[model samples]
Target: MTHGFRVASLCLSLGLLVSVVACHDNKPAAETRPAANVDVINVALRDVPVVFEYVGQTESSQQVEIRARVNGFLEKRVYTEGSLVHAGDVMFVMDRKPFEAALDAAQAELAQQKARLVTAQANLDRVRPLAAKNALSQKDLDDSVGQEQAAAAAVEGARANVIGATLNLGYTTIVAPVTGLSSFAKKQDGSYIDATNSLLTYVAKLDPMWINFSLSENEMLDLRTQTQNGTLKLPPIGKLEAVIVLADGSIYPERGYIAFTDASLSSETGTYLIRAAMPNPTGSLRPGQFVRIKLLGALRTSAVAVPQSAVQQGPRGAYVWTVDKDGKAQQRAVETGEWNGNDWVIKSGLHPGDHVVIDNTLRLMPGVPVKANLVATPPAAVNIGGPDGGATGGQQAGAAGASGPAAANANAGANAGTTAAQPTAASGASGALGEHTALYFASGSSSLDAQSADALAAVARRLVAEPGMRVAISGYTDSSGSQAANQRLAAARAATVRAALVVAGVKIERIEMRKPAQIVANDPPDKSRRVDVMFSPAAGG
Candidate 1:
């Protein structure tokens, strides 16, 4: 074949053709190559949430430092270290002999003072009567009265000493001030501790934990702008909800509301500090654990969104390659908004139901013929916090990509649901449709690598074998670049999978591209960037 191509090239160069028709026979093989297959998604008008994600930390709701209330020698720890304890639970047992002895001495002193008071009172009574009868001087009665008063005063002072000694004795047994989880003891047994300066340990209330996060000045300003322009509507400050994503990619099951927000921004960081309270009755969430706080409430209406990869940057701002009616790639400049998961919110330069190319832009150019394949964006997994304050990870179904009539219909459904707050454990979304398997994509491109291709191939084979089955595809991208670009990338990934399935002999008529209810926002970009492929038995099969 190489020799034939070379001979043809030489013949054309020598101009040894009998006619124009004969010269056409020597056309180069490269010129006759087929158009590149480009993955595409249909853009649609849907309500994109105005979401803000921030790094946050989990802290104890109430942290109490344990200390010695009275100076004494530490005898023994009553409760186990790092154990849960209730209010009034004994934490430590100090040496009580000294306090006990002091209390006994005070009691004896009080008894002695009471005896003296009795004698003085008797003397006063006797002197008063005698003095009244003129058998005793008035001075004697007055002196007796004074002696009785002094004895009573001494008795009162001794009683006060007894109460003090009793209180000191009771303080020897240290107890928990609140119900919480305890830390290890800092002072060991037999250690001498001062009442005012000793720090024994700490007890932290963990039932309702605090999630601390900050919103930067730029984010705050952007939100205000969007709100003022009517692009976004925020919930009442008190009604705002907070969702926490733990370090292990699981969400904290219980929903937390904003407990407090700083009135002013911090001068050091130029950010407003915020705190949310999440119930951690099981003590699964610990203090100092890093987490991601998802503040839900702001809603964006009539927002156009696409995969981030579909958007490309250039000297003329950001643009995406779209397939025209003639199956040719065309460049469309676009304006973008904040990222909602892996997709970008397109503010302008695109309309609903516009086809946007999502993948294989490395070799694509404007006006070039493209084998545009319409595909649906993959369903993104929505891991909501479970009822038990743990993560229940599941995939959401019916995410259509940015392509074909299916996308338009899916967008309509999505728009209908946008008016309500995002669904969660507390929002009655337990019975919504969910996906079982997820399709993932590669970095920076929509073209499938070997692993993803193999996974898609299996689905194609299943579709070919089951003629009555229909599949739904949804695309997604990671938050790495401009929102427009990521949206485009997600769309392209969905289209590429559809093209592959078509090449494997599956009928295009059975495939439906879908817009996911939510976007998958995972790490490694490759994991978050994906196309979901779900199969269902055809109607009346």
Candidate 2:
């Protein structure tokens, strides 16, 4: 191949050509060169926080099954369907004929017993004096006393029977125990029913409905520990505010509180139950209703985050592509943490000033040219303490580059914020660099000799003194090796220069690295293993 030039005669010509092209054309011409299809993003800083969301159901605070206290037929149902009814409100009535007749019989028995008692008492009074005077046998007085005792016992038995009968008669009328909306009676009116009334109706309390949800055992422990340590604060009982999201996509106006939390962990399901109370005075939030439960308070301050679109998947791991001074794409390996709603929390491999690709990268790859657009105003207001708590980790974590439709649209602007490699051409010697100040290299190597490293170091030192100056380190490799291996070689060379700058005490934010760079190949040794470092004005300068 005509790549990896091993000589010095052509490097000067190549550098001169690149400079002329940069000055002559405002756009990249070779960027359209076709290769493997891919997308890219520029690494940048953002605000990210931790959040969580869950699905739950609405339950009545109090629910009871109304049953019959006595055996009888249901006479009437006093409450209307789906209407509020109070405790002691009549719910049903049974036939009263049997109980009423029983009461009357007991009354008659008690009256007869009373009359007999009066007669016996009179006989006892008359016989007592005779026994004392010896006018009659002592046995006769004893018999009178026994008769009076028997009559008194009979009266007491009759009174007990009357009380039992009256209680049974009262059972003929049934009523509600607590106030709530009444459901359809289980058994029809005028139907014979016994102690088992068969769930006549359900009365659900709505003023303060309970929302039941569960959290994993691990999560429970984490929460407990965090609260105790003051890292995570628990919402106050009956004080923490919450909102209800209905199925129709409308938000409930009233707020609620954290009512109760289960003390014991459930054995069947390794989780703890939580009951949050919500206001439903208008009766709009009905029982048996399903809803999305969300916690409304608490927030983290000035967190670091990035749009999901800025991250991508690579053969080695997740990555983000950034731009160099000349607009060439450079890939960097990154460690991604959990996603916070529409963004991701970057654990490593990025900084506050480094630009991350945020646009569609269907045609982008290592060494490809690009243009990035900076986003001044975000599309949506900060969703602070809002319902979209956080992203639930899933299979998508492995596929880093694929973004949902919403994420793609939200990050379109950053598509214009990338680094596109410009054609190199010799420029007028009137600026920061001398006319001969251009990149040179040894053949087919990523190792920068002491001379090259020192040259780049001097440039970095000068740029450090001049804030807002930029020097893009573009690495290249000969086509003698596989594309993947060559890409690594190019990247290693760029990384080498970056390390030197950092060692020289260059501001970390001012240095950018371009990898698997735009190739300038031939038989020459000086240009093959070189990193083409270009000096230019800082972005938006």
RMSD of 2: 28.9
Error at 369, model 2, angstroms? 19
Highest lDDT model number: 1
> Per-residue alpha-carbon lDDT of model 2 for 75-98, expressed as tens digits?
778778778888888877778888
Cα TM-score of candidate 2: 0.48
Give the least accurate 10-residue stretch of model 1, judged by summed lDDT: 392-401
- TM-score of candidate 1 to 2 decimals: 0.55
In candidate 2, stretches whose alpha carbon ends up further than 4 angstroms from where it belongs are: 1-52, 114-157, 195-198, 225-230, 236-240, 297-541
lDDT of 1 by residue, 255-306 (tens): 8888998999765334477789888878898775546566676667667878
